[model samples]
Target chain A: MANGTVALEEKSFYEESTNKYSGILSWLLTTDHKRIGLLYLVTICAFFIVGVILGILMRLELIAPGPTIMEAQTYNTLFTLHGVIMIFLFIIPGLPAIFGNFFLPLQIGAKDVAFPRLNLLSWYIYVIGAILVLISLFLPGGPIDTGWTFYIPYSVRSTTNVSLAIFAAFVLGFSSILTGLNFITTVHRMRAPGMGWFRMPLFIWSIYSTAWIQIIATPVIGITILLVIMERAFGVGIFDPALGGDPILYQHLFWIYSHPAVYIMVLPAMGVVSEIIPTFARRTIFGYKAIAFSSLAIAFVGYLVWAHHMFTSGISDTARWIFSLLTFIVALPSGVKVFNWVATMYKGSIDPKPPFLWVMSFIVLFSIGGLTGLVLGSLATDIHLHDTYFVVAHFHYVMFGGTGTIFFGALFYWFPKMFGKMYSIKWANISVALFFIAFNMLYFPKFIMGYMGMPRRYFDYLPEFTNLQVISTVGSWLMGITMIIIFANLIYSVKKGKKSPENPWGGVTLEWHTASPPPLENFHEIPTVTHEPYDFSQLEEMKHESK
Target chain B: MNEDKQNKENHEHITPYSTYVLVWLALIALTSITVTVSGIDFGMVALAIAMLIAAVKSSLVINIFMHIKFDEPIFKVFLMVSLFTLVIIFVLTFFDLVNR
Candidate 1:
């Protein structure tokens, strides 16, 4: 009943006498899901920094003319490493495994995710995968140049560390599958007594949907990457075009997982936005069932649209048409989500807060990204746009604009609860502003240059594209500087910011019912949910009369 | 949280597991028969019969193993969504191949 009042309560979990140890041991050997989430926060930040630095370097190399700093081969290795690190390492596991793992069980009024040890195991597996990839970077033959796609024949013929790279991907895919399996079981088995399926938060719904994509799709990538490794190492002919194997089969296998893997990345970000928008708007989410079902719908339809990525790969015209149509179908659910979010904010007392602002920006940027995606989905348009900077800009607009923007939004929304301290929101706002401008400036020219026949993954380009590339390079540095400022603000907050209460944002979710940086065991007693999440009116009535 | 409602519901009797077993077994037997018939090369007749048997088998599996037949309508909706995805993927892929 006290939980219905929307106030933070200090409990045994936050007691000074508890075994919540200080320093490295607390982080390394902790079983607390919050601590583990923090560990992920730390690890992913490091990986993100590495990935961002790679991006800056790549942009710099492309700045002046013909390879300013590194040679073309080295540039190839840089972007390949960048793509592999950012996609497989950072974005795929971005929102769900880290934040969803930390927050979902708490949000659903459960003590922990269904399998806690397996949750910890996922982190270890992820680290091992990261280590293997880094090792591949140093291996003989100067890292793989076959791009992250690792298309066969090129992968088979290339004199790079293909086995090491693909094997690392295989390990990471296993980690992804295990995380997905754990999330599915937890959602099914671990909800509290009165917490029905419909009562669950939109964030949890997003994770639930993403979990299915992971369980069903990751294995195909695993098998595909394994066959590539076999072809490279053991001389198995599954993907080897030279050895009676169809290279296109390799593309089918890779995109089957990889395309939906994009959904896996963005769906959770959408979940993050759903949570942010309602809390900030001070209202119940508009059409909760529609938004929740849309997440699942996106995940379902997302699987069929992968072949659209292959349309320009010389697949049959019929395949192209089918994939094109399916691609349009896939956009419908995402459209539903965008519409629902706007409707949720329509008449509500809107909070111009950081998270809300980021969500709004996400809508604008992701719309551009999503609409361009439809352009690429059209068979005729994609033929011209395929493998160009148009595709590059389109993807980054969705990915960076979609997932990357939400990553910052979630950091601001939940940073207090996660760290038990509030970040400097002024700095946070500045970071968002600078990031938005720089991000667009960096990627927007890509569309223009791409249309002008500038191909992606090339170290050198014609003189015609020089001015646009120069402007984009400047934007990349601004983005880099903004990221550094963000890191500084985060560190400053951790060391010395206002100690936060549990319900800092006044959110109407079970997570807000618990302590900031919740306990070793999340709840003192298991909760029985009564109200739906985002019942902000009830929360308001309770808060005002009680005060 | 109310446990009393759940206890009262549990007191009411339902169909026995033996009935489910019989249904499952019968479905499996029909599946084998259809597979055998298909081997006889009855042209489109064999293919149609085999597919019909497969559908019956899947229904039985969902009804018994997955227990959707006894479930609330929402569960049917969820199951339908999953089945729908399978249909979309297979149909589109089939159309792509056949048309090509």
Candidate 2:
């Protein structure tokens, strides 16, 4: 406990990491990874709120058989904006930018990322891209109505602000690529001594794998978006079908980046679950190598399954079947991870805290998402269900249920470490309960509606679909309420919550070895790792020593 | 621990200027071969030959210019993995094109 007192004497990264600036300027200009993480945290939350409001509006507009609030064109623009903001601005960069930036160094026992300056520049580029998206919304031609995918000929021929929006996506891809490059370099060059590959935390493993996908796959989308912009602006004949370009080729390039980009979103969430489950279970992970290798497996296999998205898009039967097989194969690694997580929790000394509840929710929701993914991955069913609400329900269950829930779970899990304060466990649980119930209510109906042959992206629904649309709209309100409660609780807790201990969760990672909120240099002295990550004996020893 | 220290040590192997010139010449020669072979279009085989020559040229540039050959094995491993990913995308796309 003497080191705890000494750590208290050490200035936290929040207090002052640099003397050149003060207050807002200090945070704005800071190269400190933790501060930059806070910067991302604030920015993404703002974008998330915008996305949520847009989503709620879309749901409200769909509340009846006819248009409820807006015209079809307005509805189209709203969904496009909602999709663009949510996918590109919020979820894609959500975990890796916020938590990865803050904790990758701390978890690996390093002073800072290998390229701190590039890390800051990536954030700036993200903001610039966001600004361009904002500018596109208000230009002479309202917002883009081409959907977030900006699919071909329609995208090239659209009169809306498609050019700027695609360009925004291109710039955002650069931000993603740079962050991925930085993490890859940091992991490769900067692990603490004795922290062998296997000894590193599973969170590090997941982020490393996600980073590789970000680096390799993002460039394809970047170029694809650029080509779309060119086709729009300069009349380039690349992806425009009218100009003798193949529209399916655009789908190929788009999904090539985007399908793996799904892994980019969810893999880090998996990483978060990996960290949370072991900590809550108070045990070594059931199969460390299996879980770690599965991340690599998922990443490797994820790249091969992009064309599964195009099964019903007039792609050849051979490509369709091959991609369908690869899609199912990719699920095997995810299955491995899911099984390993369940096994890790079996017969262990379980602590069902707020974070653990979220992990449990993630397991259920992501399982539904992953299992239903097979139905859509199959060539026959996809032809039946493509562009239906079934596909919508599937991804929302996976992306929102898997990644979005874990994003909050990680926020709760790492709250104390990041902010040096403890949020109310009661409020946290209430929020999770509302979220779980409301989330299922919101998206589960889509599966049924989709099976009943209700098409997605429709401004108006048939009278038969009216009841489910109303239910889904009601669910959106509950989701909005849940968001309000969660954000208000955390923001209030930041100033008024109880002061947390250095290691609140009995977490055995190197991040827990540092001060809550961590110092400017992270470690007082870099601790040499002799035990494997998730070693419970060391955690117990540290607990006893602290006591 | 010793291996850790050894990995940390900056083993900067500087390539000679002559090596860069020779690699550049080889790249130019490969480019000319691709261009010349394109003129003589051996049906479908021409595309295959051009791609093969382009791959070899890129490997040389990556190995010597990017220092993949002089660097640790892990770099080469990652490079191969990335190339393999590209191969997967191309093969899958071609599956559709060829079949259709």
Give every collision pair in model 2: none
Worst 10 residues of 1 chain A by lDDT: A10-19
Off by over 4 Å in 2: A1-6, A544-547, B1-9, B16-42
Residues A383-471, model 1: lDDT tens digits = 89999999999999999999999998888898887778988878888888888899889999998999999999999999999999998
Q: Each candidate's interface RMSD, rounded to one decimal?
A: 2.1, 0.7
To one decimal, what is the Cα RMSD in angstroms of model 2 from the true structure? 2.3
Tens-digit per-residue lDDT, B36-58, candidate 2: 88889599798789889988998
- Candidate 1 is scored at a TM of 0.87
**What docking grade applies to model 2?**
high
Give candidate 1 misplaced runs (Cα > 4 Å). Answer: A1-23, A541-547, B1-100
Residues A214-301, candidate 2: write the lDDT tens digits.
9999999988988887787788788766778889999999999999999999999999999999999998898999999999999888
Error of 2 at A205 (Å): 1.0
Deviation from native of the Cα of residue B43 in model 2, angstroms: 3.6
TM-scores for every candidate against the unseen true structure: 0.87, 0.95
Question: In terms of DockQ, which candidate is strongest?
Answer: 2
